[model samples]
Target: MEVVAVGGCWCDFVSISPKLPKKGQTILGSKFLTQHGGKAANVAVTVSHLKGKSAIIGRVGNDFWGENRIKSLNELGVNTNCLQKTSGHHTGIAMVNLSEAGENQIVGIPGANYQVSAQDIDKYKSIIEKAEVVVVTLEIPVPSAIRSLELSQRISILNAAPAPENCDPALFTLPTVFVVNETEASIFTGLPVVSFEDCKKAVKCFLEKGCKSVIITMGEKGAVFGSDATSDPIHVKCPQVACIDSTAAGDAFVGVLAYLMTYRKDIEMEQMVEAACYCASYSVTIQGSQASLPTLTTLQQYFLEKF
Candidate 1:
């Protein structure tokens, strides 16, 4: 495997509302759709979309949705042999509410997702060891992620999301790169990330935790990447686009990042991050998770037309 994504897999039940509902309010939605989701699953699908060899290790319910999740990943060309089905649990699920602005509010019920354990990591160690890069997310338990980090042979990307209230400081130092979107950056470091200067301050805070490198995705403003080895931090600005659904932008970024780390190992980090930003920016121009991701052929066409 070129990349193995370890985390959660869920069925997303999405609805488009005029606005996100507030406390004690009832609202009507314009549209509804059921789609494939889960942070790690989204990452794997993104890698496969880019034609990279990808696998996913996680658990789902032994139910209809679980079967559908596995089948979809297979159709997308992601290896699903390592994904497991839990007997007594329901497949993980997320109720997604999207506003016309393309912003989303999600409430996830982590059924079999929380079932992924350290023992599961042991069972999949060989698969995990074969990758040049292993992408992980916090949608699953912290201990399982820790176990994967301990077993990973080469590069590991810990996308610390849904930010933990109490995190093991060592998690920041374990991976080849620690990635977070602006909201997560603010949560983990207790610093507001509203400006480029704020992102730099957050970068300093993360690097001081002993990471070799860190990348913060700042949405429409683009992203910032830095390394402990170099004092300079690189900021790559994204091209403007008419945004639709912003839900999977980070997954697109992480997916492209993992893909380049696997197949374009000799490329400089700055170039890789820039490509990821472009891919993520493109994802927002469409709607739906996984479905919005661009294939290698499509992305090439997009570059020709847009660039």
Candidate 2:
């Protein structure tokens, strides 16, 4: 496999509301839809959509949601040989609310997703060992995440989203690339990331903790990149666009980065980060999770129109 993603497989319940509701208030939504989601699953599907060979190692419940999750991955051409179904437990569910401005608030109930075990990771050890890029997220059990990190042989990426309550210290030292959003950067570094300089400091914090490279995604401002190879950090600014929903923007970033690193070996990390930002910025302009990810053709057509 070119890329292997070890994390959660979820069916998202999404509502496109005119505005997000306040506490103890209700609001009518403009529309609603359910689609395949979860960080790892979205990454895997995006890789496949970009014509990269991808595999998913995760768990779901023995329920309708689980069935649909597997069917969706299969239909999308993601290798699902390692996707397991637990006998008892619901598949993970995400309640996603999108404002008209494309902002989002999400709460996830990780059901069978939490059932991903270290043994499951061990069972798929061969896949992790052979992949060009191995990606993991925090949606699955901590043990499983740790095991995947331990087994990864080539480039390993840790996409630490839905920020951890108490993060594992080793997580900083293990992955080749550690990615987090600006808010998450503040949380992990205990420093406010309000400006560009603050993001540079956060990158320093992760590198000191032993990460070979770090990326701090600053939402609409774009992302910053740092690594052992340089003393200076690089910031890539993205284009602003009219957005309808932004549920899977982060996942899209991770997936595109992995696809480029796996398929286009000659591309530099800076260019990969730029391509990722470009594609993820495009993702927010559309709706749904995997549905929102821009394909290679869409990306080509978009930039050709813009430039």
Evaluated at residue 290, the lDDT of candidate 2 is 90
Give the residue spans of candidate 2 off by over 4 A.
301-307
Model 2 worst lDDT run, 10 consecutive residues: 298-307
Among residues 3 or more apart in sequence or in different chains, the pairs in candidate 2 whose N, CA or C atoms overlap within 3 Å are none
Candidate 1 per-residue lDDT over residues 1-307, each given as its tens digit: 9899999899999999888899898899999999999989999999899888999999999999999999999999989999999999999999999988888899999999999999999999998887889998988889999889878999999999878989997789788899998889999899998888899999989999888899999999999999998787789888788888988889989999998888887878987888888889989988899898767875565447655
Estimate candidate 1's alpha-carbon lDDT, on a 0 to 1 scale: 0.90
TM-score of 1: 0.96
Question: What tens digits encode model 2's per-residue C-alpha lDDT throughout 1-307?
Answer: 8899999789899998889999999999989888889999999999999998999999899999999999989999999999999988999999999898898899999999899999989999999999999999999987789889999999999998767878888888888899999988888888999788999998998898888999999878999999988899999888797877889999999999999888888868888888889899889999889999879886566447656
TM-score of every prediction relative to native = 0.96, 0.96
Question: Local error of candidate 2 at 163, Å?
Answer: 1.4
